[model samples]
Target chain A: MKKILRTHILLFLLFALLLPSCMNEPVMPPNTNEGNFEALWKIIDTRYCYLDYKNINWDSIHDVYKTRLATDTTEFEFFDLLGDMLAELKDGHVNLSSNFDRSRYWNWYTDYPSNFSGSLISSSRYLGKDYRVAGGFMYQKIANDSIGYIYYGSFSDGFSDTNMWYIMNYFIDCKGLIIDVRDNGGGSLESAEALASYFFKNDTVTGYIRHKIGDGHSDFSSPQEIVTKANKKIQWQRPLIVLSNRLSYSATNDFINRIKASPNALVIGDQTGGGGGLPFSSELPNGWSIRFSASPMFDRDMQHTEWGIQPDIIDSLKVADVERGYDTIIEKAIKIINQSN
Target chain B: MKKAGFLILIIFFNVSVYSQTRNADTYLLSNVANTFGFGAISVLDPYLSPLQYNGIGLKYDNDNLRFLDTEKLNLSRQSKFTITAAEALNPAFTSLMMLVGANYQYGMYYHFQPISDLKVLAGGSCDVDFAVKYLPRNTNNPVNMDMSTNLNISAMAFYKLKLLKRDVQLQLSLQSPLLGCMFVPQTGASYYELFLLGNLTDAFHFSSLHNKRGFQSRLLLHVPFKRSNWHVGFDFNMLKYSANGAVYKKDDFGLVVGTTFDMISFSGRKNLPPSNFKSITE
Candidate 1:
């Protein structure tokens, strides 16, 4: 009986000793205007990857934005103010979504010339109703039956294997394939990789991707290389011209970077809109949604492409050419194809 | 949290004197329970939202204990596994969050009997907990991952009595986490940064009373039948941890019903000790 009592006392004392060490301090700020402002500032300060690269003094930006936040500020006003603050990043992927409105920075494309004309492609360039639509691509023979023109408008769209195989077969007899990905704001990485795989004869290492492992700006994992091997079922061995414009972004930017590595591929048109970072979502205290780039992606040389990917041949649309119902970029691509052959 | 631990210890200490003896032939016992109840959840992730939600929870527990052969020094090894899922509602923004959690615990205890019908078990346990809470509507940050591994002190009391011409058993148990480590990203850190970039600073943190506190308690009742026992119970569990300026708290209480059975038992004169040789006629 004494032994049982002693054993019980010892166990009780063990837990009593542990009772003093368990209080934890709360980490989040209160849900007020000042608190929300600070939280937003901290979210970007810690999670946004481009602060150092973009050479923006985020501390000063916070100082400027905090002055705009008043106790009487309306929800829309606060939303606009936050949008203004994010605009400094000049990134298209950074967005603040609310029930009222969504904030976006579109200068990445709006400030540049619109090199693509949908009407011109439909009326004159796509062989005037002779083009066939297979999956997300509109393809036809151009340059008097010598060049294959394939216009892919968006990466958000998916295409089946059969669609791709048929498209490749249709272009099999052409001199070369002109792949136009203009105004494609990007979509699935799997789709992007699948499309890019066709240009390679062998396995290709196009770029690298790394995400945040900790809170520090410099805290990142070792870069994981992205490999896109050729799909032997319907590989494109002929000369390939990938046309891109300022609106080609995200996965489109990635496609351009990958295709640029292929020996038989050449990029033509304006520099692509850069959206190299993979975006993720979070929310503010006010229930407003926030989306920003979380992971950084790189090109084959491990260089950041968040700003934009430069084309091998820099060419802009000529107003006169548009008036004459011709695509300057497509014409240039056709010329290059003829010269290379 | 510490106050709660102290209260549990005091209650168990007072009940230790009435410990009852258990059948020497019993070796392995397995218990399983399924429960459902309502609880409250609070999350303070600056990237998500700062709101408290009330929701329903479903839980299940499986425990196994094997007693060692000893007279004065009675001992047992126990293993327990638990799964819980909860969905909460917040009227502030018409928002909701779903959390799914799983845990496993293993420990060894000293079993004691100070009276004819009461038994006390006390020991230390190590637990690993992993949970994920997801908000379907949050745009910027939609998910929070919760994970921790801790060493805890545990105590249990078992009481057996005859009621209505049938044998009944009642048991109460508590476990308090003492020390361990947890993973929590910084206030503004994203999983992309933590998982993809591999930035683990402040991610693996030491947990103690200052940064974490929680306890699990349960009261179970058993009614024996011909070959097995039908069990019914209530469980209350609370967990709270704060690190890198992010706070996570979960409180759950539910009614449980299950069954218990002995997996292996010693029988007859062959497995009995020589001291029981004359039990048939003496």
Candidate 2:
């Protein structure tokens, strides 16, 4: 009996020691010559922590790639296959690099650079105090003729009531204002509100927030803060012209959408960046993080701003206009504003 | 009977002498080389109640322990050192261990441009020699290289507690090496300094100083295997990063579950208890 007990103890100890080694998975060197497509697939299979591809049809993407790999001979074909796959993901983080002529694609795609020589201003140093040459937050001085001009680079940050106070104070006396959110990639809605509030004096209907529920959707209007103090200083009544381009996005798009609904506002320039939603972050298993849109947004009139916001005046710029040093969009806006006056 | 007693006495004496000679504890306390390699005497001391093997028993000396003394002992140590010091004063007092580790890492800094737009916008800008351009009519271009070496020294300390006996460990680590400079060309300057220190093992082993970018803080919850020296855990980190002067600061968190194997062990000669076997036999 004693001998049996001792044998059992020894066996248990041996098993305990060997079990850990047996459980550990063997580490193998990665196959480098598996081709780019195979390598990418393997990486996603092994490294990607997320099980769900956000309801995206990954199998279809794989099937397309497999079909391409079977028959496609050209390198450009492979590149297009990868590009189409990435586009299906709809994730900004996922991208592929290929050796291809970029200038060919550049020539095919239309570029819109809004040519408006103007200064930018903010009420507080938080937004920016200095009047930069172009595409930076700057303060605008409203002239006695009730005309206001403000140039902004991007509207992604530094937008607050305090920061917008300077522009508001300047435009208090002006009848009309030119808000150049042309190249603004979009920022916070609070800054947009500061700009939007100037047009909509009544706090009753500001904007709306759209969110995704479990099965359906939901929408909520922004709360109103009554402006008790009357403008004893400067007061003007004229139409406002908001300058924009394809780069204008997020809060910038929201601003355009809201102002377009108003009776006294006009949107001028090309389409916007087509980003109109609240952003959210998600964690993947492979320790890679992704920030994406969580919910789709809409204006007061239940209009979605997803496929780029259309402007009132489709004042698109051309290369010929650039060569001639003519800002046709701004000139047209100025002309319209003058004609209205 | 007499012969057996004498044999026992001799065996005990020999074993004691051998054990004394093989004592790692003495070397750990007195040797300067061991101190530099591992750490000070306080760190080397055993924490848990030592288990008895055969006739010999090993026990931790807890009477002379002090925080300041441990800190002083660790002053001279440098490079790749792990100190796990725990304190539990009373029954009501919660047990806590402060774990700190440091390691020297060497790796390359890679700048990945996702799109070609960034490259065209950044690379097209050229530099002209102001002195020659304004005065002389010669066109001389200066050599320019965009890559640079980033040397960083990072140190972090965390307080860990065993939530359940060997099952879970909850830790909150303070971010460190918070300040470091990257040497890059003036034109291609971007703040890519965000680092998320994951696990204690990962922080010590795989973490590189140059790759410490795109995450400001991290929180880790380790789920350890019961009765096994292996753990598979999850991690979440917050990242604040920017590119092309566009700040994209968000709660960039991630989850990683990996297993760790503890392979380190201490080996030493056996110690024998004192005995008067010779006299008793006689």
Candidate 3:
């Protein structure tokens, strides 16, 4: 009887010992100069959301960059080469953050007109000294209280539902509300969604979001619906004009996408600098950080917006208007509001 | 597959015990333990942050031992659970990153006495690991997830001696992961693709010594009073797992303190005196 117990115990131990042999092949990429280069290339190749849409020849890009790699290449030089490789994707969300510098692509706004002039706004007394601050938004009555103007500079700053209630209530008497998001580089999605929800009375299916699921570049999961529910707070039912420019990006772009469906809303300004993908970060073998768009966000029509989103009514900044201390884009929106009233 | 493996192990043990000679005397022993630990952890995901963190943890352990032969062999099982919170920094130590983790393990052992004062045991165990690391200020890729399951080989030793004319028990044990499966995104894959999209292909990785290995060691001491005994011990644990160009490691050392109880014992013969096993309180 004791011998049987011993035999069973031995067999159990043997089974335990044999399990290790079944492990799958390792997927660890090497850590070298060429290794780091190949690693970055492969990551972007598989995970970056806009490769096919943007029509980038990733393999050709790899061939061009591989010649620059050497065993003795300096870390700084290697970083430059990697930065250049990433720039080919022409995405602002893609960056390489390091102790010395953070690489970026800004042609989304740089090559276009600077449709916003901050100095002119300050001098025009449009946002007077008494302009109230509601989270990231600064607001006041403009054109002699004929129209309500709210300039949202960024989405990073958070505001409570109470703050939104106060801002919309203060503008309740105005002919129309102008949401000026010029040069508003994006921040939090939650903040953007919260503000956008105020314009809708029902649950709105704003867009679709999907991410890479496998190692293959074309591998992706089914698109998930991105719904923006109506705000539980005070809703804004007045005529809404959303002012945008080349610098209105990321979540700001998402905000415009949300408000576009509103019948009372009109998007007027230069084309918006679009960043329609959610960015995720990674690291290289050398410990340098890499940030790239991992998930693709689409418009209601399921069209890609990585390049830029077209304005319903395109309006470029006039130097003449700036010199006269008037924002031409704001003037156009105010005229449209007054004409409608 | 994991459930099936667990059931097979249980059946194997039950059959082994049933086949053993029915000793006239048998005893059941159990103990509960609490441990507090401090440890350093490093996580390297080429697609996430490449920094290490340090943090504190709390652990709880429960052990049940049944002796079939007072001096020869016994069956034992241990369940341990732990939770940890840690942070990571850059070379300057100014930038901070954070992680919170939890682990639970269960081991079944068969003990045999090789010498008069020493008892050795061999066994197997299963463990589950879960963790989430958050970078306080990272905009896009701010959170990383770590989770896995492991089947391990475990061993233990016990010794009894007299200290200052009082009987004392000393015990040590080690458990090493031999085979397992874990969730690993390909070098650049995102959780959205794998979890939300159900891209499970290559998500469940087969892990072994080549890609994952680790050991946990525990040393415990038991002191007797008039009734139950006082238990105090130290524990050291280390684990390293690397796959898909990512590496994760954990090192922890802790102090344990608890108490022991003799829950139940049934003898085939009548009126058995209290157990004579010196490796644990009788």
Ranking by DockQ: 1, 3, 2
- Backbone clash pairs for candidate 3 read A282-B47, A283-B46, B53-B87
Which segments of model 3 are wrong by more than 4 Å? A1-32, A70-74, B1-30, B38-80, B87-97, B103-130, B136-138, B146-282
**Candidate 3 structure quality by residue, lDDT tens digits, A1-341:** 45664585466445543433344332545667887788788778877878888889999999998987877888788788889999999999999877888889998899989899887666545786788898878889888887888888989988888888888788878989999988998988778888888888888888877767666677766777777788876688878999999999998998888888766789999888999888887666555677888888888888876766888899988889887778899889999999998
Q: Judge candidate 2 at residue B129 and give its lDDT.
A: 9
> Chain B TM-score, candidate 1?
0.77
Predicted model with the maximum TM-score: 1
Give the whole-model CA lDDT for all candidates, comma-separated: 0.77, 0.38, 0.74
Predicted candidate 2 versus true structure: per-residue lDDT over B6-56, tens digit per residue: 334322221111122223232222111111111111111011100100111
- Model 1, span B184-232: residue lDDT tens: 7664455644564355656779998677777677888888888767777
User: Ten residues in a row with the worst lDDT in model 3 chain A?
Assistant: A17-26
- For model 1 chain B, give the 10-residue run with minimal summed lDDT: B12-21
TM match of model 2 to true structure = 0.38
Task: Give the per-residue lDDT of model 1 (tens digit) for A281-335.
Answer: 6556666667788778899999999999999999989999999988898999999
- Displacement of residue B46 (Cα, Å) in model 1 is 7.5
DockQ for model 1 equals 0.18
Per-residue lDDT over A1-341 for candidate 2, one digit per residue giving the tens place of the 0 to 100 score: 44663474356335433322322221222322124455455333322222132454555667777766744356566556555654554433233432232111111013545434332123221123544333235545434345666776665555544455555565666656777787676775555655566565444343444322221112222221212122233222478888888767767886787677556789998877655545432212211222334344565555556556888888876557645655567556667887886
**TM-scores of the first chain across all predictions?**
0.92, 0.59, 0.95
